[model samples]
Target chain A: MTDDREKRRLDNTIMEGLRSMPEVDPPKGFSARVMENLEPKRPSAWTRFRLWLTEPRSVTFTPVRMIPVFAAAMVLLVLGFYAMDTNDSGNGMRMSTIRFVLNDSGMNARTVAVIGSFNSWQAHDAAMRFDDATGAWVLEAQLPPGDHEYMFLVDGQKLMADPLAQMTRDDGFGNRNSIVFVNGTYEQAL
Target chain B: MALLAFFLLSASCAWAGDAGFVKMADRARECGVSSGMIGQIESFTAEGSLSDAEAVSLLLPLVAACADNFPLASFEDKLAEGFAKQVGPFSIVRALDRKLDEFRFARDMLQDSGGGVAQQALVVLGEGLSKGVPRQDFKTYVSMYGDHAPELFLTGLEMMSLLSQAGFDFRLTRSMLDVGFAGKGLSPEWRYFVRIVLVARQRGLTDDAIAEAAGTVLEDSGSLADVAVHLGFTSRDLSGRGLSN
Candidate 1:
């Protein structure tokens, strides 16, 4: 009980000393300095750009001064067109894809292939797949741009002509070979 | 001295075969024959499709063609075609001989018609000659139209062959080419004369009818596409079924 009384006396003495202190005014512009410190730092580049854009500026107009700019534009346009043309020519050098189709609806052929100058006339090099929907044998080949002579070999024994060939030529071997002109059209004669 | 002479003679003979082979290789390079062509022939021998003697016979004419500066591709292509067709070795040799003759005839014609002919042009003209275009007709066409651009010349020759094969009269064929080469009526796209003729034939237009329509429209500086339209040919007739077909 005596220790509790001593603690209460010390607390009262400190409280009385704090209550006896007098009120005083702060230094001049102290609150203003604090407010200034609280304000944001330097503006960003985007803000400066927006401020510059909103500000007015004068622009001059003269045809003679634009001549160099116009010439540069023309040069750029020409280079662009030249690049486009070069790309087109590169594509032109590529081999054209030609589809060879043989309509063997009634023959019920077990095998069919395309023999032509493009493949050195190999019998089985360009075998055609039988499409059930169309009932035909079909093959596609990449051939250079030129005239190629071809024929359909049916079932490894019979040499058949393309029934819908655009042009047929004498194979000089007593058989007619289909001639397909593979040009820009990518069209197969048959 | 006697021993030295024998060694020198032996060395000369030893190098002779290799020198001949090197010379032949040089000629093949000049004539556009790939060295692999020999490899193909040797492969044939290995495959037993050609005897040693028969292979030599096939190679002799190719070398002769090279020595004469003839285009070897036709011979090469024919040889490959014959082998691919499984025609015997002798048959391939005979075909090569025949092709050599065809190329000779073509070279002679090109020479007779004012020589300065390119190898590709010679090949195209040879194809025309072989397809049965008359020598006189080819000479006239080449003399008249061959001096222009190489592609145009080649196209003209190809058209001559195809049209003649299709039974178009020489004079009418000549006239169409004249209009195409005139450069006033037809577009510069006349470089594709072969394609135009192909589409024309595919449309089933008669030779006389095409000639008539071309004579009327093209002579008056009309467009190439117009000649087909003048003959009542539609875009559908000109168009193909393409890959879907």
Candidate 2:
């Protein structure tokens, strides 16, 4: 018992000495270094119990049974991601998936491309593909959030606006260009 | 990465192949279409008096000829509306052209005015245009909402459209707005008051009395609904029914 008391006294003295030492700011990257080296902490008993309480699992969930829940989770996830992708427009930077389609511009067309402000108005670039299912020439692109002016280049010669566009703008030269608004709502979580 | 790839893979199969679709000619370049919209279009063409080519020609230009980022879904919906009404292709196209023009005009106004709730305001603007609200009156509301979000602008236009639908002239609608939105931006209570005023007008209430009631609704501490009930439309006792009673 006497030896244990001496040891405690010595430890207290050492702790006092350490506490008396001057304080200083940690070196740059100190936090990063510490975090890199840190081990994952185990949860407390109460926390583990709370987690168990929250995570309710049905004992009857066979592989088939789990499929519906899994599918529902996936749908929610996709919708959530899509909503985020379409809505977020922070700091003037926006990203969105825009699908462009042209039904029937002309009977004799060799190539069709969507040229827009997003692609520096390149006529040949952003080529639309003839969709088999819908039978409409389609081009899907990721464009920034805003109003984009564009036109379809048909057969590498004719340029025309989207006939389905609800709004039209005079493109300086007698013709009009279709304007697309990309409201980036589906942002990637990563 | 694995989860994302899995999701993409699943979605790919979802836009799967279906029969009766006229597969794109090998030379044709189109993609991103998985819906059987073409078959439906073909079926629609079959139902109408026009030939397949003629129907397609009319339908195809609906989206293509439009300028600006018009919602294709909305265009399709309007097309459906026309079809439902049994309107002819030429008339439908003309109507669509007019609708697109209205959307452009409203879009330009919203952009120039600089406000939130633009979509709702655009709807209200369309209604106002249909009611023949003067260009100058639109300017008044546009300026009234200077640097403010479009909530009140939408509300104001909605009020105007209601008054117009009630057979009150554009001048009366403008006068009511001049009174209701006289203060700093709009209050939610103001809309309730507008409804109350509409009911009053329907009951043959004079303009002067309605304006006084509007002033009372704003100045008094009682809620707009309370004043609205005080006016009429509510199942209130007949004592407060000042004019038409």
Candidate 3:
């Protein structure tokens, strides 16, 4: 028991020596030196702009939240089209909504279509929808840029020309084909 | 100042020369014929062999009659052309009458079939008559392709005319038209088809070869580049092939 007590006393004395050593503080101006080395160099305006332009960015959105976002976008897109719609119409496909309109009143027609070179001359293929408000038949088709020969087919038969077509072609037979000179060909009112 | 003086001189001369073209002058004034046109008419009537009173009386109203059917300007141009050729007023009147008839015929045929005839086609019809492209040929082409697309049919006719001008035979021209118009100008414009004809002619490709290539291009090609690729011809290629074409 006396020997055990002596060993415990020796261990306690060594621990006290270790705990009592002088506290070592950092060298003078150490924090200032570290901050001076760590601080980055100021980039030039052009360099900063280069970085800004070339930087890749990630965008995130919830699928559920995207529904209203897409709906709003569609509404804006439709309104944009509406805003760009002009009272004047032309043969050019300058915009997506190039409307082909024909007015036939009191003809007792069941169907009307604006078939042209664009739709392989199949009358019912590009069938026109009747506009109740105007009592007219209208079809909106995206005609490719170039001259197009078209005619209106009434009720799947009775191929007719747009009487007011800007130009017409003699179908070498005994018929006149309505001509639509698309894109870049301007027609001034005679 | 010179222009004004010249105008005054011409106006006074016209007023003085009114003695010869009295009947024509009265009719011309009634039909809104320009003074410049009247000057040409009167000068032609005065210089030509026919009697001014008779030729003017007969021809001036004949031209005026065309005012409703054609642009009066076109009639004026034809009259000017006849004068430029030093043809007599009576001959000019006869030619104008024939042209008016042709225009009426082409327009009637167009209307009777279904309707899609171009005003420019009138000029083309006149040119065809002058170039010896038989009217029956025009009628045949019109009937064959007119039912589906009028402009395409007419454009095909024009393309044939152009190809013929480029030295391709009528068969080749017709063959090109048959193939190109088959697509209704959706993939390639009719003008593009004309370009193909020109290129084919430059390459000295046979009509059969051109027709065959055009079929492939119209079937598979959607652009001028695609056509060039399919036909194995380009603007660069045309230079080496032949510029005389």
**DockQ by candidate, in order:** 0.14, 0.01, 0.01
Question: lDDT at B74 for candidate 3?
Answer: 48
TM-score of each prediction: 0.66, 0.41, 0.43
Top-lDDT candidate index: 1
Name the regions of candidate 2 deviating beyond 4 angstroms: A1-190, B1-40, B57-67, B71-74, B114-117, B130-133, B182-185, B189-198, B220-224, B232-245
Tens digits of per-residue lDDT, candidate 2, B1-245, equal 33543443333224323211233211011322213334445677577664444344334424342335544444444455344334565555554455556666767776777663355566566545533455566666677754544566565666555444444455655565665555533453344234355456657877667665655665443444555565665534212211111
- Expressed as tens digits, the lDDT of each residue in A111-158 for candidate 1 is 998888888787767999998898878887777656677778788768
* Candidate 3 structure quality by residue, lDDT tens digits, A1-190: 9999999999999999999999999999999999988968899999999999999999999999899989999999997886576323354244233466777668878998876656655555688889899877888776554446567778766777786554455533235657554432221100
Q: What is the number of residue pairs that collide in model 1? A: 0
Give lDDT for model 2.
Answer: 0.55
lDDT of 2 by residue, A65-173 (tens): 8899999999999989976855544555656667788876345466788776566555556888887676678887767644465778787667767876633454423
**Tens digits of lDDT, candidate 3, B16-63:** 356546655766666766677676556656776545554454344344
* lDDT score for candidate 1 against the true structure: 0.68
lDDT of 3: 0.58
Clashing pairs in 1: none
Candidate 3 or 1, higher lDDT: 1
